[model samples]
Target: MKLPKALAFDVFGTVVDWRTGIAEQAAAFLARYMPGTDPGAFADDWRNLYQPAMEECRSGRRPFRLLDALHLETLVQLLERRGIGTAAIGEGELLDLAYAWRRLRPWPDVPPGLAQLRKLFPVVTLSNANIALMIAMNRFNGLEWDAILGAEVSRSYKPTPQAYLASAAALCLDPQDLCLVACHHSDLAAARACGLQTAYVDRPMEYGGARAPDGSYEQAWEWRAGDLLELVRVFTSH
Candidate 1:
């Protein structure tokens, strides 16, 4: 089947590897700020803080916080836990490092796959990544988005009706006229429920885990492909 007029992607894991990206950046920052520190190890430790930080809010220990804020909080906590001093870290200076997310190296085939798809559809993003993050990502890394829609615009998180519609509206198309492509099944399910076409691109490393994506993920999506490259073939072939 031909893809819809717009292709909306889930940013974090779908577009870039946040865990790996942040970890690498963490190592570099820690090295600069605290020499003799093993940044790789620090990075790994820092990554471990992401999910729990979000879950605390999701589980009601804290209220909803944007992903950016959560990352900052997690970084700060991890820095303390690591015995690294934070006197050098300035207000929002470290958070600004989130530009790392924007500069993340595109998945092996992402740039090319997007190139192919853009021939047929206007490419865009629908992600939890903040607006400044997305804009800087484009400026630094050549992400050729016609427009970028993030939770910052809708002031709500993904899988919400509003997030999906934010992309649809930004594209100036109806939900069905847009396609939401993500590695996570939940994002696709919510987009589908909102009347958008769905594509699930498998990024098994999204969680930095070895186990296969659960059986439920196999059940939730309309189309599944190994990655964005394969997805291009799958979508355009039919």
Candidate 2:
């Protein structure tokens, strides 16, 4: 495959461990608000809402929304279910917690791998997460992206053609000239459909409490790596 001019990352599952990050933040929030809630179990419960929440939009039961909005709603519902009464929390707090994703910890290899890749490619985030969230995340996580981009600009999230096309167009590159690097096959498949090259980075611990289902790493990826640093080495021949 030809070298790509831009490297677009799938933020949530690929770059950061959203499950662990959300769980850790939820534990802190619960300790502060609800008090005594298990960050681990609470995290599992909170994440359970993720797919169903998106299904609501994809199924047309609700209109499409940015991932941030979906995440807040999920958190609120989780708070209530964990015996965390709604009156105990405020919308401001929910919003703040949603912003917690911006500060999420990168997988062990992310920062260093990015440092290596940045020297060879213009790195940017192509995520379902919104701009404010992405910017806050950049500062929080010490990410060094040359640019932050998202479905916020396209007004649609991943698996949507508009989102992928909009990213390449926004970056002023042909789809084939850009590579979408992500752990999720769903995301990279979308990029492939949009005419981009693809690389699959493994984040086997994205689910936090459990490993990703077996064979998830063996999808129809053009290139696969154990981590981002390995990916950079594979791409740059360094």
**What is the per-residue lDDT of model 1 for residues 1-238, given as tens digits with 9 covering 90 to 100?**
4557778888777877666766677666766777787655565566667667756754557767777677677777877776766676776667666445566656677888888878777788888777777777767657687777857767567767887887788777988888888887767777888999998887877556644344364555556788877887887776
Q: Which stretches of model 2 miss by more than 4 angstroms? A: 31-37, 55-64, 213-218
The superposed Cα distance between candidate 2 and the true structure at residue 58, in angstroms, equals 4.8
Tens digit of per-residue lDDT, candidate 2, span 67-87: 878888887787676667767
Q: How many pairs of residues collide in model 2? A: 1
Candidate 1 has a TM-score of 0.79
Residue pairs in clash, model 2: 102-137
After superposition on all C-alphas, the RMSD of every candidate to the true structure, in Å, is 3.5, 2.5
Q: Candidate 2: lDDT of 127?
A: 86
List the global CA lDDT of all models.
Answer: 0.73, 0.81
Query: Candidate 1's C-alpha lDDT?
Result: 0.73
Worst 10 residues of 2 by lDDT: 209-218
**Which consecutive 10 residues in model 1 have the weakest lDDT in total?**
210-219
Pick by TM-score: which candidate is best? 2
